[model samples]
Target: MTRNLILGALLSSLVLLLAAVSFIWTPFDHAAMNIPAKLQTPSAQHWLGTDHFGRDLMSMIMVGARTSIAVALVAVGIGMGAGVPLGLAAAARKGSWLDELIMRGNDLVFAFPSLVIAILITAVLGAGAVNAIIAIGIFNIPVFARITRGAALSLWEREFILAARVAGKGAARISAEHILPNVMNLLIVQGTIQFSLGILAEAGLSYVGLGAQPPTPSWGRMLAD
Candidate 1:
């Protein structure tokens, strides 16, 4: 399991690094039109050939990586920022009305699929990269909250938690110092999964013309084109 986790982390990191590098340099301008090269097959000059719009495929793919990565990072940030605290609160106050409220709110958010929720949000906010990030991020909040709450609840019953309580550490401090550290591994694993999902979601939204605007390459939009 450790080896597999390390390999997964390495692979994900490499992909993200490549995506970042693509932002500074690509084989060609992704938006550059070459009418003569339109729909051309791969050749010496055009490595990945040209799209119907005469844009370079390799360039488009590279630029799209930037879009995908940006969306995923922002969305994950939103999820962790909002969900972790709520989850910790729920776990610290387990069985109380606050816990019930948090869990129930998570359930309500989870009821809708990410894509459907994205569509609704895009409809209200209008389609753009910022909207896409916000929509995907909101959808991810409940997922992380539930995961964190579950892990923290288990830790709350551990011997160390008892010691912390006896030491006069408040619930919030104990949760931050003890529970969060213990459950961080779980959060890291879940964050990776959500990051991948965010990439796909951003692409899908862009493909449907509800994400990043034109001239800005997006994998989903590229596929759609």
Candidate 2:
């Protein structure tokens, strides 16, 4: 593996381990406050010291990692679950009104950024992690749909796809069996990119006060403070 990949793996593993451990234990209760200790410098008693609220920074950070991970993970899942099938259908029906409709819908969604979408949803739902996830997920659907459709289109004309059609396999079957497998590598790469973007999106929402609420520490909120 490349050096960058190795370093990334190690760092990711460390973060995952820290988040997991946080569920069972932390240096101190993340929400517990000791106002007198606020802004104390890092020391043996508090490796990362204290925040302005006097909460343990390290504990807050540990819990925050999981919160970010959970939001990003679920948002990406929502995107892939909804987007992949829509893309496949559009690709299979290429040139049909169905294809036109799906693509046009994607275009409509693409017009709005995730932040804009978040603001709209949060306006109705009130700001929270769930609303942020929904916003990010909606934005992601068009992205994954576009990627899947484009990749699937190239494979549609391949000899194997043509042969599958001749063998009485339907569009859905061919897409699931043939097209999806061929495009999976591309999707995996795209998913990784999306996952990172999801984290950033979550952070942005939190920073703007549209994400996880107080008592549920967020990296973005920490930065804001």
Candidate 3:
């Protein structure tokens, strides 16, 4: 299982590698249309053939990869940034009103469907990459909140954590100095998982015209059309 996870990570990294490399070079321009070459089969020149619009398919895939990676990274970053702190606070406070407030807020956010939330956000904010990022990022917040809270709950009971409490440490300070450091690894693993989910969600949004907008050559948009 661990070997499989490692292999999956490597394969995923390769897609990002190609996408980053695409910034420097692609076999053909992704935007330029070749009407005469429309729908051409894969060949030495067009490795993945051409789309119905005569855009080089391979180029589209490479460029699309960039958008996917960017959206996922930003969305996951937002989740981690906001969720981790909320979760740590909840754990540190334990039975306090702050814990209940944070957790109940998370539950409320989680109650909404992700797709509906994205659509609503895009509708209000206007459909584009920025809105899509915000939508996906918002959806991820509750997920990380739950994960972080669960993980932090256990760590809060550890000897080190208790010692920090006994050492005249404030809740916020102890959480920052102790809890965060302890759960950093867990957060990273969760980040990677959320990153993948964000990519899929971004694609779904794009497929429905709520993501990166036209001319961006998103993978979901490509698949949609």
Clashes of each: 0, 0, 0
Compared with the true structure, all predictions reach lDDT values of 0.91, 0.90, 0.88
Winner on TM-score (2 vs 3): 2
What does candidate 1's lDDT look like per residue over 1-225, in tens digits?
A: 999989998987877776887868888888899887799999988888899889989888878888899999999999999999999999999999999999999999888888999989988999999999999999989888999999998999899899989999999999889899998999999998999999999988998999999988899888888
Order of the predicted models by lDDT, top scorer first:
1, 2, 3
Candidate 2 local lDDT, 83-160, one digit each (tens): 999999999999999999999999898787767786687667878998888888888898889999999999999999
TM-score winner among the candidates? 2
TM-score of each prediction:
0.93, 0.95, 0.94
Error of 2 at 157 (Å): 0.6
lDDT of 3 by residue, 5-78 (tens): 89998998899888999999999889999888999999999999998889999999999999999999999998
Pairs that collide, model 2: none
Sliding window of 10 residues with minimal summed lDDT for model 3: 174-183
Q: What lDDT score goes with residue 65 in model 1? A: 85
Question: What are the runs in model 1 whose C-alpha is more than 4 Å off?
Answer: 1-14
Supply candidate 1's per-residue lDDT for 76. Answer: 98
**Per-residue lDDT value at 36 in model 3:** 88
